[model samples]
Target: MEIFKVEKATLSSVDDLKAYHAHIRPFVLQRLEEFRETWERGDEAVFEELVFCILTAGASALMGLRGVEALRPVLWSATAEEIAQRIHFHLYPAARAQYIVAVREVVRNELGGRLKAWIESWRGRDTRRDACVQKFKGIGYKEASHFLRNISFRGYAILDKHILRSLHAFGVIDSDRPPSTRNRYLAIEQRYLTFAHQVGIDPDELDLTLWASRTGMIVK
Candidate 1:
C-alpha cells in the first residue's frame, strides 16, 4: 500500500504506473471476471446487487453483503423495524428501511424493474448516476457508480472511501476527505477516470485495484 501513498514509492509518472499495473493485471482481471459473472446472472440477480450497493452507502461493502442477506427476502414488505433488526449499520434502521422500500417502488414504477436496461440506456456514466440519484430515495453519486460498476458497466467508477483514499495516496486527488458537493464529487470522479485511462485499466477494474491497494482485499 505504501507503494501508492509514499511520494518516493517508485511510480512517478503514468508510464511507471502502467508498468506496475501490467504486473498485477492478471489478478485484477480475475477479480473483475468474478464481478462480471454476478451481473451475467440476469435482472433479478442484478437488482440484488443494486440492493447491496444501496445498503453499502456510508458503510462497508462486506457489511452490505451481510445486510442484503438479512433483508433480501423481506425488502419489499417487511416493517422498518424488522429490516432494521437484521443489520448493524450506523444509520436509523427505520429510515434506511423506508428508503429501501421507496427505492424499490421508484424502480418498479419508473423503470418497470429493468435497472440494468435503464443504466445501459444512458449516454454516459454521469447521466446514469444523476438519474439514479434523482429517482432513488437514498442513492447518491457514489452508490449510483457502485451499482453501475458492480453490474459490469465499463464507464463508471465507484468512488467509495477506500477508492478515494487510495487515489489520494497515489496523488490522483488532493485529499482523502469525501467530496462535499455533487460538483466536487464529479470532479474527483473525473480524476479517477483519467487515472484509469492512464493505467490502461477499465474504470471498474481500476476501482477494485485502488480498493485492494488500500484494504488488501478485492471486494465488490
Candidate 2:
C-alpha cells in the first residue's frame, strides 16, 4: 500500500468530513442500495461479486471489475489455467485463478451450488463474514468484509488501504498499518465505527466517502 499523506490538519475536522459526506451522500447510498439488490440477482451475481473481491487482492477495484466482466462467460466452469488466461490486468492472475477455481469447487460440491442460500443461512452479519473467511480459499478478514458489504451486510469494516489511511488521517487510528490479525482488525474496525458515529455519518457511507476521496470514484 502507498503511504500517501492525508493532510489531517485540513481534512481531520468532523465538520469538514460531514460537509463532504453531505455532497456525496446520495451516490454512496445508491451504491449501497445496489449492493442490497445484488441478493436478488441470484447465485451467479453474488458469486461474481466474490470473484471481483478475489481479483482485487493486490489489484485495483476497476481492474478487478474488468477482469470479472471478461471472465463471466466461463466463471462458473473455467479451469485455473483458463481463468488465469482470461483474467487480464491483474498482478497475480495465476494465484487468483487458482483461488477462484478452488472456492467455486467448494461452493459447488460442499455448499450444494447454492451460494446465495448458504450465505443467507447465517443468522448474524459477522457470522456470515466469518464463515466466508473460513471457507473461501482466497478470502481474508478484509476480503470477507468486502464481500459481505457488497452483498449488503452491515457493520463489518473492509479496512482496505484507503480506509486505513483515512482512519489515520481522521485521527481514528494511530497509524495506517493494516491490522495484523483478526482481533486487531476487529478492534480497528470498532474504532472506525466509533469515529463514524461521532461524526454522524453511517460507517458504510464514511467508508465510501474516504474511498472516493482517494480514487475519484464510488463503486461497489
Candidate 3:
C-alpha cells in the first residue's frame, strides 16, 4: 500500500471526506474487522454475506441488510417463491429471490457445500471476482466486487454510484456513470485504485468513507 501525503486539502469535498473519515475511522475499522471475522464463522455465515450482496442488486445497502435479516431463518432452506415472499423491501425482489435460491442450490449440490473453498481456489481477487460473475446469475462485476469486499478482500473497488460520483468529483474518474462492461469497469477500478494511493486512503476504507458521506452510515 502506497501512502500519500494528506496535507491541508485544496478541495473542500476531499477536505470534508478526510474530516468525516477521522471522526468515524475507529467505527469503520471495527465494521471491517467484523467482515473479516465472518470468514471464520463457516459456510453459512459466508453465504449470508453473499446473500447480502445479491439483495443489493438494484437496492440500497440498508435494504440489502434488511433483506438478509428478514430472510435469515430460511435462507438456506426456502424455495424461490418463499424467498420472494419474504423480500418486501428490495427493488427487484422476485428476481433477487430467484438468484439467491438458484445460487444456493448450486453451492450445495454441485459445489458440495464448500462455497468458501471454491472462492479461495480461484487464486487472486480479480480472478475470483470474474469466476463469481461467470458462475452466478444475479452477480455482475459490482455485486462480485461488493461480495469480495464484504468478505475481507482488499483493494477491489465496488463501483456503485456514490463511489463513482466521489471519484468524478475529485477528478479520479471522468464521469460518474457506472461502467457498462467488464473492460470499462476494470479501467475505472484501476483509476480508483490509483486515486486511493494518491489520496492516502486504503481503497477499502475510501469506499466506505465515500459511501457513508452519501448514506450517512458505514455498512458492509
Candidate 4:
C-alpha cells in the first residue's frame, strides 16, 4: 500500500468558498445561495446542526432530511436526557438510540454544562473538530466529516461514497481498499483538500457542490 501524504489547505473567505464551488459544478453558485438562504431562515443552532449531521450519516439526502425533521423537535424543546429518551422511541435500529445518549454525554462533559459554549468553542478551535467528533462513541471518519461539513468547517472536506467514487473516477484518489478502513478515509480527505485548494474553494463548499451534483438536488 502506498502511504498518502497529508496536505493542509485552508479557505479563509466566502469568496474562496464560492469560487471552489463553481469550479466543482457550474450550477453550485445558485445551489449554494439556496442552501445559505435556507440555513439562514432556519437559523439552526450549532448543536442542532450537529444533531442533524449525526442523523444524516450514511443516508440519502431525503432520508437524512426526514431523520432531521424527526430529530428537530426533540433537539429544540427537550433536555438532553429527554431527547435521549425520545430519540430511541422514534429512531430505530436500536444503535442510533445508543448513539444519541453517548453524544449527549459527550456534549455535557466536553462543553462543561453549556451547549452554547460548546458551539462557540467549536467555531474557533481547529483541533476541536476531531476532538468533539471523536467524543461521540460510534462516530467515525465519514460521519465526523459529514457533521463538520453541515456546519461549514473551513478546512475540512466530507468523504461520502459518492464523493469518494467521483474522486477515484477522476484519478484524484485510488480506490484500492475497503471503505471501512481509516487509511481510505484519510486518503480521500487528503486528495479532496488538495483538489479544493487547486480549485480555490473551501472544503465545505466543495462538499456541498459535490453532494448536490451527485445527488441531483436542484440548487434554487
Q: Which candidate achieves the best TM-score against the true structure?
A: 2
Candidate number that wins on lDDT, 1 or 4: 1
Segments of candidate 2 deviating more than 4 angstroms: 1-10
User: For residue 58, what is the lDDT in candidate 3?
Assistant: 83
Error of 1 at 114 (Å): 2.7
Query: Which window of ten consecutive residues has the lowest lDDT sum in model 2?
Result: 1-10
Residue-level lDDT tens digits of model 1 in 96-170: 677777877767787898877776788775777788788788788888878777777767767778777778777
lDDT, residue 151, model 3: 82
What TM-score would every model get versus the actual structure?
A: 0.82, 0.93, 0.92, 0.66
Q: Quantify how close model 3 is to the true structure by its C-alpha RMSD in Å.
A: 5.1
Cα RMSDs of all predictions?
4.7, 4.1, 5.1, 9.4
Model 3 residue 32 distance off true place after TM-score fit, in angstroms: 0.8
| Model 2 residue-pair collision total | 0
Global fold similarity of model 3 (TM-score): 0.92
How many backbone clashes are present in model 1?
Answer: 0
lDDT, candidate 3, at 180: 98
Instruction: Residues 30-73, candidate 4: write the lDDT tens digits.
Output: 44444444444433454555665566564454544555556676
Q: Judge candidate 2 at residue 158 and give its lDDT.
A: 85
Looking at model 4, the pairs that clash are 20-201
Residue-level lDDT for 77 in candidate 4:
49
**What would you estimate as the lDDT of candidate 3?**
0.84
Instruction: Score residue 80 of candidate 1 by CA lDDT.
Output: 66
